[model samples]
Target: MAGTEIFGIEEIKALTDVIERKMIHRYGSHSVRNGIYRVEEFEEKAKKITGSKHALALTNGTAALITALKGLGVGPGDEVITSPFTFIATIEAIVACGAVPVLGEIDETLGLDPVSAEKLITKKTKALVPVHMFGAAADLDPFMEISIIYGIPVVEDACEVVGGTYKGRYLGSIGKCGTWSFDPNKTLTVGEGGLILTDDEDLYFKMDCYHDHGHIHSKAHDRGEEGKFGLGVNYRLSELQGALGIVALDKMDATLEKIRKTKKRIINSVKDTGIKVRPMHDPEGDTASHLIFMLPSPEAAVNFSRAAGEAGTGFSIISQNTWHYAKHWKALEEMGEKDIFGTKAPSYAAETMAATEAMLSRAVMTGLNINMSDGEIERIIRSVKCGAKASL
Candidate 1:
């Protein structure tokens, strides 16, 4: 589930170049650094890939989200709607902004249900965030429609699907603002980094100043002397991470190609078993980092999971996976119970999220390896067949 699997001498070489120069800051070290700016270069590369006009690099994805929200002027007494089936970072970013996170139910795409989101909107709603789960996109057209209709900004959380696209456009590029993660577990690893993609120029500058210590960076003014935008935080990306990011971004096409092939092979092999592959808004543009299937019922999912485990090809039952799903988020649950999210004791109980609960409960998935051996693939295929048999 990581891009680190393919790290090699290129990563080492890039790091060595930065270390040998003794340049580790992303900004303002011109004399000794020979005018090199790896973080700027990295942002440029990201903008090119996603066709975004501006890209802001940060310390991690969570910071990117918080900054993007802040740039959008999200703050106290406001509510931001997003899917319940996302990393806790999404909610945390909203909370960090002194805003409330309103969860919308997920549809078959395992993403925020547009209708559900629209129904939850109030005058306080500031934004709509649609998370691209796993390696594929959520249904985005309706979310875009909702955004336009309600005059709400859509922030695409493409963290899990870094290289993935939707309708021939990159996932993050489709929204008013998009964000991606480069954690060690992501398809593009920069050790720990995050980025925001946007076409809005003013929004870009706002985030730029907000990520640093409020100084609007300039070549002439020097650090701390530049005019301040406002109060800010230190989510700056190190030049070291930036150097590694350049190499990681270069490998995205190859990584996506490899993972997509692995997923296609497994999906093709299991199609005859009456199991349903998870739906995607843009199948062709999927990163295909994971192979997920929908069983007829939750009981079948349990059986399938049991069989897969016994066969030594353990599948992730998404409902119980604390890292990705909201049902397991005790902190959020507690917060919601206190009516902190602008709703009265919001529920994570299965009955409350019947639609999302049913879909995630009946789903089982496994991550694909970019460097999977033929023998390993064969074993996985055999194990999937066993699970399918048990499911049916």
Candidate 2:
């Protein structure tokens, strides 16, 4: 079961055909044209889906975030507020841009708490990254107000909630700029890709340069004449990946619909099982239902999982904490003394200490993929309810 895949053979075959036909590398050959075309198509499709004026295709979601942060002029000594209960890639991007990530707490909906975010802001605060974690939009109105009052930028990490909406506006489009991931595990995939969407022309131009290595191809380049303007990374997506993205983009609406239906069914099946369903915002708005979540106490979740196994109903927590964030935390801890940024001065930065301790204390999380079948979920729910009685 661990090795069994969720996607069907047709999906794999379709992706493979695109990969085979497009033939990967497009740096300095005619194949570059096809890659560029596919990327353009993906950008256009994404823009329409996200309701943004401009979209840029990039290497991966992390690159999209770093590009957005760099474009916003975030750098060393600058503090950007973000939720700690997210994939480390979000924090990694902040670190890569030489900015400090001031962690914020999450609400029941699992998004950054607007009040908590406001408390973390300071004179050096430069940006706010509100991740639409697990497919639910964060309460954006308050964050938008905070950004407005402070004159700071907001970049929505809509990676997991691309098609999700809040208050009628699309999740990513609600911010100054939004970043999305197209990894295999995401709501949609291009094998490996990302997109950045923005309404600001200047931000669009700057991010283009950031992703491309500080270079913007002239109109001639768009028309097939090669002249370098500056330096940029070769963080461009492959034609095959772009093609696959286009195909996937076409299927997004139906895919998201199925996800919503599956989510409802699973939630109903599990509601009476004495296991807690993950909290969510009103599903009527813009939840893409990316990953189903549950917030059982750690002990309860462990017991439920064990009982599930005995009943032949497999399930798992998000991951063992030892395995989930160890690499990132270990890398930070190894920095040692002077390397650990704020160690030398204990009482020096009260805010930093408070934020760090608060963030670390509230890190428990659990998730289920969107691929579970109805029967499997029902069986698991049955097992959980039975186990709850047995424990009593």
Candidate 3:
């Protein structure tokens, strides 16, 4: 707990030194903007690692989702079914594309419940945005089946998960388009950036052009050196970020191994504490172990968090009710009787009200940082045991 940083500051500083020395090209150059080159390089490495045909880097994770949603033709009147237990960015991206976001309950994996998800689908449903919550991939078999049945595209919100594998296949590679965030908190870090991966040629082209500025000759460069007719923003990563990304990618295997070990330690430590640790459903493959979470009774969870923090254990509430659910409630209720997201209720109003109640009453989330050392895990366990004892 003493000066245990989530990531090595010295490592980042070393990489930054290389950038400052101009050993690496900076982003935003005429030939290859420092940002553009870095983003492109990161995407290339991502493609190679994930086995995807194309990769596009955008400004941030939210922008990446927005780009994918827009590229997939999700617009006004279209609905995208996604789990409510996710970051608002997923919902924001859908809203940005003028699409209605449908709320689906989470299953064991804390991902979209296939059964509940199926109930939400309708003719207006355009895509499925299954978030790999806390680096754990959702059950893709049912998601894939639903996609095939409804003929809708799948855009995976894999921002938190980098190396998560589901059913022997990579999480991002299974969907039509997958977006990843390279924020420092994620499994991988490129300072602050996001990437989109896909095998679909058309979708790739649209996203590629959209990230750059609406118009850029594939082989050469943009027609207008000064400006362009197409549309795009400065959603690019610096070459420096890319170089750091390369270094980070090299350590992915080691990072994941360490994460798994830590997760096991934490899970085992809490086994007899009576606190129900959430299970990561990886029936097909391995989870990235981004954040180990638990959904204990709200009151107990609060007390546990307080005790842990006092004991020098870092405890975080990853999912705070805040203002996200209200927007989701309104969006879902506005869907009318189309049933774009599965619910027993006949209209969006009924479903939203019910979902709102469920989310408010329960929904506890905690995280285990990948860099957590054994001592930290022990401290956390001791705190949880103490809390459990108090409850008894």
Candidate 4:
């Protein structure tokens, strides 16, 4: 999961070039820029890789998400349906735009359940953010169908699976707009960066100016002379981050390849002991960041964790993971959106999504590493095998 594990001369060279140039700003310093624009280059590379007609680099993934949401005209009182099993940034982005964040139930893929999402949609539903959780595709077919029928745009959150694809299409490029994170934990780490990809020219231009003080960017005009589109925020990516990102794209393939192969090995080993591995919609397209097992019951999942510990490895149950699971999000409860918005804040109580909760409670998972050694893989395999024998 840590792309930093494979860092070498490429990353160093990128940083050195940025330091030597002394042009840390992304735009308008033409005199010292030396005809080098790493941020633009990074955006070009991102567009080519993701097949997006336009790509905009931003300060972080959260910023990208917010920009995309705002670009679609989501604002006060509007509803955006997303999965409860995603990073908190997804919810925060909606709130940042004064939109109501609606949490939908998840299906087997550990993403938004399409049926539940459709039921939640209304006239105020402006977007359907189907997060590609744990490096696997959500059941996007139904989500996309609902999007087309309801005329709501889908903002695919591919932050967790940077280089992953869905049915041969890149995850971020599949929806109306896709967003990605390039932080240290992602497949392509630039230390801290985010990207937005879209084919809609209007949306692209809107986000571009909105991320940079609402100045309409043009090569012919100087930075200060550019026309203002509207009020905007400084979610701009720096030249240093851009330089890091250019080289980071080159490292993504190797990281993803290693993750896919190693993840398959671990899953195969665990499945042989009759442990049910989480199903994949498009197995070949998965980034394989995580290998999940669905135990027969929550009690069995606890035993499985003990088995993993005994084998000198670690396993996590989402039911207990406060950071990612919505049910445990005390921070959300504390914020008390119910009073701020007209409708009640969406509930995260276990009973509200009983089936999804049951599934989460019976599940244990481990993240795959780009730097996992063969010995480490074997050690995890042995842990599952031995653990299953004692626990199951």
Best by lDDT: 1
Tens-digit lDDT string for candidate 3 (1-392): 21123357745785776666564543334454433454456677888888999888766789999989888877777878887767778877887777777777776556777888899889888999988877678888888888888898889998877777886777778899898887766766766878888999999887767766775534344445534435766565566766667666666777777767776676677778666655656733444353334544556556656665666665554344443343345654565565333423234454454543443333444455567756777876776666555432
Tens-place lDDT per residue, model 4, 147-202, is 89999999999888888888888989888999999988887788899999999999
Expressed as tens digits, the lDDT of each residue in 50-163 for candidate 2 is 778999888889999998998888877687888755787887888788766667767766678889899878888889998887678888898889889999989999887767
| Counted clashes in each candidate structure | 0, 7, 11, 0
Model 4 lDDT, full chain set: 0.86
Local distance difference test, candidate 1: 0.88
Between candidates 1 and 2, the one scoring higher on lDDT is 1
Please list the C-alpha lDDT of all candidates, in the order they appear: 0.88, 0.67, 0.68, 0.86
lDDT of 3: 0.68
Ranking by lDDT: 1, 4, 3, 2
CA lDDT, candidate 1, residue 276: 83
Query: Which sections of candidate 2 miss by over 4 Å?
Result: 1-36, 222-230, 272-276, 285-328, 333-374, 387-392
Task: Flag regions of model 3 displaced more than 4 Å.
Answer: 1-37, 217-230, 283-364
